[model samples]
Target chain A: MSHPTSTTNKTLAHPLNAWYVAGWDYELTRKPLARTIANRPLALFRTEDGRPVALADACWHRLAPLSMGKTLGRDEIQCPYHGITYNSAGRCTSMPAQETINPSATVPSFPIVDRYRFAWVWLGDPEKADPALIPDMHQMSSPEWAGDGETIYAPCNYQLVLDNLMDLTHEEFVHASSIGQEELSASDFKVTHDDRTVTVARWMFDIEAPPFWLKNMRDKFPGFEGRVDRWQIIHFEAPSTIRIDVGVAKAGTGAADGDRSQGVNGYVMNTISPETDKTCHYFWAFMRNYCLDSQLITTQLRNGVHGVFGEDEAMLKAQQEAIDANPDYEFYSLNIDAGGMWVRRLIERMLEAEGRLAATQEPQPARVGA
Target chain B: MAANSSTVWQRGRVVELRDVARDIRRVVIEPESPVRAAPGTHVDIAVVVNGEQDVRSYSVVESDDDGTRLALSVFRTPTSRGGSVFMHGLGEGAEVELTQPLQNFPLRVGAARYIILAGGIGVTAVLGMARVLARLGADYRFVYAGRSREAMAYLDELIDEHGDRIEVHVDAEGTPLDVPSLVGGLGRDTELYMCGPIRLMDAVRRAWQDFGLDLPNLRYETFGNSGWFDPEEFVVRIPRLGLETVVPKDRSMLEALEAAGADPMFDCRKGECGLCEVEVLELTGDIDHRDVFYSQRQQEASAKMCCCVSRVVTPAATGSRERKPVISIELS
Candidate 1:
């Protein structure tokens, strides 16, 4: 039995605004790439000038994905199931099965852009996109050369990871045998958090680094005994996402200019995306002031990050299982964990900004700058 | 005269082809428009090689709901020059001109028992009829016969789903088809329809007649001359309209008439696609029910020619009048 309500309810909100990474450029060079955005399957493609476009995955005629289709002599995606070809704007271009080519037909297409070397898609309203207002990335481009960048998909919400990354103290326990040690903030180093994102930065000066296997500084310097310089930066962007940056600044002579350059400063920015309420994906890009060739800078950084991600996945999975077992495990919030509270506030504010926030929940507008 | 009009739409190139069996093929057609054909409606598929409309009529073996796409299984006739040449050249998505559907073969509408018989690739037509029958929730018996099992297309689909109601006949060494025994098996209420090479149809007709049984309406579709498209039957002239033309006797009466000059409006062509069919300005013909598409009443009142199938049966112009014709011209 169907209710005789208004018929306009068929179309719903497309989770847009903020930045949504569509896919890698190399993979979908000539063919349409098939993926799901905002809980619906979509095909991402390009026009001749490299402008990216996304459309509903299935063809309106046969319900076959446009991605499985081929481009006709004219610019468009054709369903492989049937030869029904559609244009960039999701309009049917022609029915090859017919005797004549139809010039007027179409399908629904999503708005997309390629900026900062990433294919960012607008899953919601096209009218709201402002190119001038893209996500901020201060540590990218040319030399102070950024390290290799890589990506990984997580089977959980992008929010949870943002919260986890913001609460970096977890690495001490979660990554105990890997990147973190329990001695991180034992003596009240410092912590900062408000709205937007949390930053736990402090001068780790003149202190022996964690272990004998932590990359370049596995062993401590006699002159710089228990000493090194490091600073951490992290950002949480909307709809559903998080960004984490960790950098190391040098205190002495520099190899970069041979004229006492400012030592080594490294940065790792994590871009997390919420594919669904329970699934998330992250794109991690690394940058370093120290010199490294394209091969080592590219290949090794990806491998190393992937290895670290493998560990995080196992821990996240187990943690999710525990949460599933107990629906009502109320836990108290701590001052040091201020980053997590802000991440939730950001999600709520983004939802509200898009008119998607629930009426039952009061709007907790997170204070912007931290 | 509102159903059968003879007009030829576009024809396409033979693009893709594959041999599904020893002589059967899966021919995919890339049409020029959305065909939205029902399952049972047959399309006139004309393939030209070396430049001739070597036309072969085949029922759509399968059709999508919108009638935009269709699939047919044609059993290649190796002996016929036009037939063999056309079949061997078919490739995937090749262009083929198809007339809008001319649905001449129709099952008795409503919930009636349908008995379908296919002789060989005669199965193509009934195969479509069976599908519509299933969709309509009507009970049916599909009697598929061939020289042997290999000749039958999609034999497995029938065997898998309708095995209980299906009957197979072949001129085998050991087992034979008990025709009388098979006919003797049906109850009086069943509607029987048979399509195949002449012999099998003859056998079924004889058997059913011998029993003096209540037979279902028996029908058949035979190939017509290319004149099916010629509308000129005689030198026609719209006196006041200044229209004078010769309408061929062989083409659809309306087309020939229209061409020579009398434009008779029609509607459907199975005596159904009647874009040019119209009321009687003058009527004549056996009014053959060869077109199973229309009802008895519609056919009667309309005095329809289904110009695709109907022809003029002139009275005085019968064989003798044109012997000495030297009539002068005087027009409006």
Candidate 2:
């Protein structure tokens, strides 16, 4: 193991206490769902609901990806290339032809967990993974009036959004519509950084002032007259989960269902996951808690968020392209860039803490293909 | 037991089945698993007329895979479902089991020019050797003799598959066999593998002696089964374990050992199956060699298969009084 000099080389392979957003809960089912973390392809599907299972993707027989295979009625995955099937724990189930055989014919599988509506994969030291240590999501469970939400996939690194979300000032300049116009008062928001998580809070008012969708009760919504009454709370738990608050009406009141998008309305909560350093998966769900017709709310929320995600796609793609073109380029900063600096520093510190993992995870010599 | 009892595993459909003769069928066991019996190597085949393990061995004639299909020609007998019967009854698209490759008889190695004599289905195993000779561009002559031209299972097949490499001889002219001419002036590195009924093989076997011909080799595969093992009741002492047990004729030496509380490990069961091997502390009987294990010298010492095939000699049966102390037969 060599000493890691910087945080840029850190990956999900490292064993860290930092939070990692595995995937949407729905991604796991009785079937096998394959995902790659830190370039290591893995199959992670729940044999049953409410579980996050992971296993090495390749079969021992022919090195075929079990992820590409399917499940038989025995809760075993049949290798698509051959008829060899393996069970959940990765044991060879049937040889299809032999009545009896030598006893060394099985594949390998991994340990897993299902928690907080997200398929949380243990992207760290599996032996040390204590389910109690996973981040608790009390916010999602509270019976608060919230809007319905949707999920979207982004073709950019998840860290980009972490950086994007942590740096609160990107909204005013990048997003000219909706809540992006909220101005950050010079010193209104206080910032706090902890060893495992970070939080940022500030106040902004007159958010429904212009180009805003709420036209019916624009005057009726609270804090519509003040220039800075909107209190924005931002939280960035590492790996890739960011939460924020955009002060708005309680769910269900005509405000939550206000005809805002084009002519429709909804609320959104976005989650960003790194499909890879070059591609990211985004999931945003609409929290339509108070909506009278929940099904209709779910549909509207999916469509509206999908459209906005389409817009985000165009911008992120361009951003990734520009980054690729200018890989060696650097950026400057000023005092107003406090949010970006804080998040970056937090990442650097956390990565530095995982020095052991990074050191031992050096790449080995490439195997010659037979 | 039913004739079709030895087959253990198979999943491919039969591509074609031809009753090339009254007692022979050319079965094409295609792309299921690979059948790897060499030119003279044999395999145990199980044909399930009902549900039982009645087995018989057959020599593999060919092995090839072209991505499209594989083919095997077997001669099934109406009286014998084990090999000939199974193959004869197998229809196109019918499933069949070809046990793991068994090398009951390996090809005589290091022979350059050779004479291969076949009688009936005995030619099946020798076909592979002929094919190998052709592939390697080696010099070899084949004399394939059977009842008749059309009645021969692969008579035309050998002609179509290997041209100019074989000489077809049938017993249709009401003439005696020409053993002298066939065995004359054979090359130095040449050998003879005569496979057929006992009489033909014995005749071929004696031709070398009669002609006083010094040939490279002469080998044969006989229609061997049933009495390959004889059952008898007796007692054997193990000097190694210092114990004596009842030896039952119906039970194999391996079964006798375990029945009397001795431990053993094994694999295949046929005498050809090399599992229940035991060391001979001492013995007395003509070591009838049916097993595929051990060498000539070992069998000469009366040391061999105690599991399926072996006999014991008593003190009065043998003249020796002062036997080797602590005489025993331990696990092999």
Quote the positional error of residue B181 for candidate 1 in Å. Answer: 83
Q: Chain B, candidate 1: TM?
A: 0.65
Worst 10 residues of 1 chain A by lDDT: A3-12
Clashes of each: 76, 34
- DockQ of every predicted complex: 0.01, 0.01
Candidate 1 local lDDT, B148-223, one digit each (tens): 6777777788777676777777664344466687677776545676678877778878888888753323445544
At residue A341, candidate 1 shows an lDDT of 62
- Give the lowest summed-lDDT range of ten residues in model 2 chain A: A258-267
| CAPRI tier of model 1 | incorrect
Question: TM-score per candidate, in order?
Answer: 0.47, 0.45
Which parts of model 1 are misplaced by more than 4 Å? A1-15, A97-105, A138-143, A187-203, A211-214, A217-226, A239-243, A249-262, A292-294, A359-370, B1-332
